[model samples]
Target: MAAGKQVMVIGADDSEESHYALEWTLDHFFKPFGGDTAPFKLIIVHAKPSVSSVVGFVGTGAGVLPIVDADLKKMAARVTEKAKEFCASKSVTDVVVEVMEGDARNVLCEAAERHQASILVVGSHGYGAIKRAFLGSVSDYCAHQAHCSVMIVKKPKTQH
Candidate 1:
């Protein structure tokens, strides 16, 4: 309690795999970090593409900003809400929710740096090695970019 709690910046999005990762992380890491005696800070980080990313397509049309802003804002709020529900369901306390605007990899890394996280955790989308080569993986990018150690959790395969 006296010492500062270590931060674990988690990258989340709107996907079943991401939820699986959250559950996996809570099952494995939460006990060690957020045990009954002491709890470490758990930060849920979600990234929403910035409106500027759409500015070119919108062409600065009238009412465009308002519509885009509302949609983006609502999506971000939903993401954070989902995070909160998940944390509560897991009985996780000492949790922080951050909804950022930008590329997922960049926002997540920036959050880790800002929070001075000891470790960063993200879920693998289960892309094949060949596909991963063609389409860069977020978890891979984060592993390479994050300042601290990274954990990439993959969803368990479902039985037919």
Candidate 2:
């Protein structure tokens, strides 16, 4: 693996599965290639729903829109902090945390392309075939569309 390669980790709503995937990438991929001798750049991407969707549904009528700006900022900050911690633990010197507004899959793929990422890492929700067919899966789309390699970390299943 080449040093200083760009790796992009797609983060969701801070779910346990996403956290696990982040940790796994840090442990297995970033840490191995990140240090004084082996330096790598890590970019954490968090996708928020686009405001256009909301505006499209709800017209700009004269009404007091409950702007939860503080909440959004807090959530973004939390994600950034978590990503920072992971990078720090793995000794990744160059790290960036980006909170973008768009659909998850589209944002992730776009970021991967824009960054010319060597690899894209994302968490799998483990939705069944039916669910995936109906709702689509970000990991699946990214794996197919990304210009670079893609890694998906799925949550451990419970033993029945």
Candidate 3:
């Protein structure tokens, strides 16, 4: 937490697109100018879906709740580790990683407000309009709800 530096909140998940967003942010914002001492304080947030939300109806899957919960916990750990490792690899170790439980849309917006962020970065999943309508878009919600400016980093289509 560097004094006088603006805070940047980056939304991370167990997705390749999110990793690209992290890498892209480091390269463009932290790498070129900041080096070891970045101008902006970085906070990486990973939203863990609530067990009930993941279980949905939970009738037939009720018995597997424990299993699902364990899996989710493991995933969260992996996400946090990956984020930390990636930041370390880029020599940007002055980072705060948060794994909160809730919907990503709300979690990211809350993080931006909590940290008084100057910018919020998220990866675009590139879902079609129909799919986005049904699945909802975290990036879209954050763009409109976050207190600070939002950056939706879309991975190159050819990269994968």
Candidate 4:
């Protein structure tokens, strides 16, 4: 394995599957690559809902527009901080946390391109065949749309 920095973009959200994918990434890639020696330039991406979706909620008042924008910024900061904290706990030092405003599919692919990521990682939510067909899985979309290699990590199903 090349003992050099590799850019990896991971699509994350406030979901159990997203967290599991992070853990899987650390265990499978970072740990096996001799930890900090190879140095992974990780980019954690979280996509917030489209700002247009919340426009009506904020009303057409000009006075509080800045306030609404500030609120959005704060939410992005919180998401970035959470991702940083989680990556730090996993011994991932070189990490960039990004919170983007858009749908997950487009945002994730755009992030990978902007970051020049060598690989993109996403998690499977384990949606059923019918649901996946209709709802469209983010991981599946990333695999098809990402600029680089993609890994779709699925949580193991334990037999009861």
Largest TM-score belongs to which candidate?
A: 3
Residue 80 error for model 3, in Å? 0.7
Residues 1-160, model 2: lDDT tens digits? 3565545555555778888897786677656655534344567898866545555566755352334444555777887787777667767756678888788898999988888887888999999999999989999999999898888999899899
> For model 2, which pairs clash?
none
Q: Tens digit of lDDT per residue, candidate 4, span 75-149?
A: 777767877787778777777787888888999999999878899999899999899999788988888888899
Model 2 CA deviation exceeding 4 Å by range: 1-6, 33-39, 52-70
Candidate lDDT scores, in order, read 0.83, 0.75, 0.93, 0.81
Off by over 4 Å in 1: 31-39, 55-61, 129-135
Tens digits of per-residue lDDT, candidate 1, 46-138, equal 998888787767688877877898898898888889988888777786688988889998998999999988989898889999999997788
Task: Tell me each candidate's TM-score.
Answer: 0.85, 0.79, 0.94, 0.79
lDDT per residue for candidate 3 within 1-160, as digits (tens), equals 6777899999999898999999999999999865557789999999999888888856546578898889999999999999999999988888999999999999999999999999999999999999999999999999999999999999999955
* Model 1 TM-score relative to the real fold: 0.85
Q: Kindly indicate the candidate among 1 and 4 with the higher TM-score.
A: 1
- Model 4: pairs clashing at backbone N, Cα or C within 3 Å: none
Better of 1 and 3 by TM-score: 3
Ranking by TM-score: 3, 1, 4, 2
Query: Over all chains combined, what TM-score does candidate 4 have?
Result: 0.79
Runs off by more than 4 Å, candidate 3: 57-62
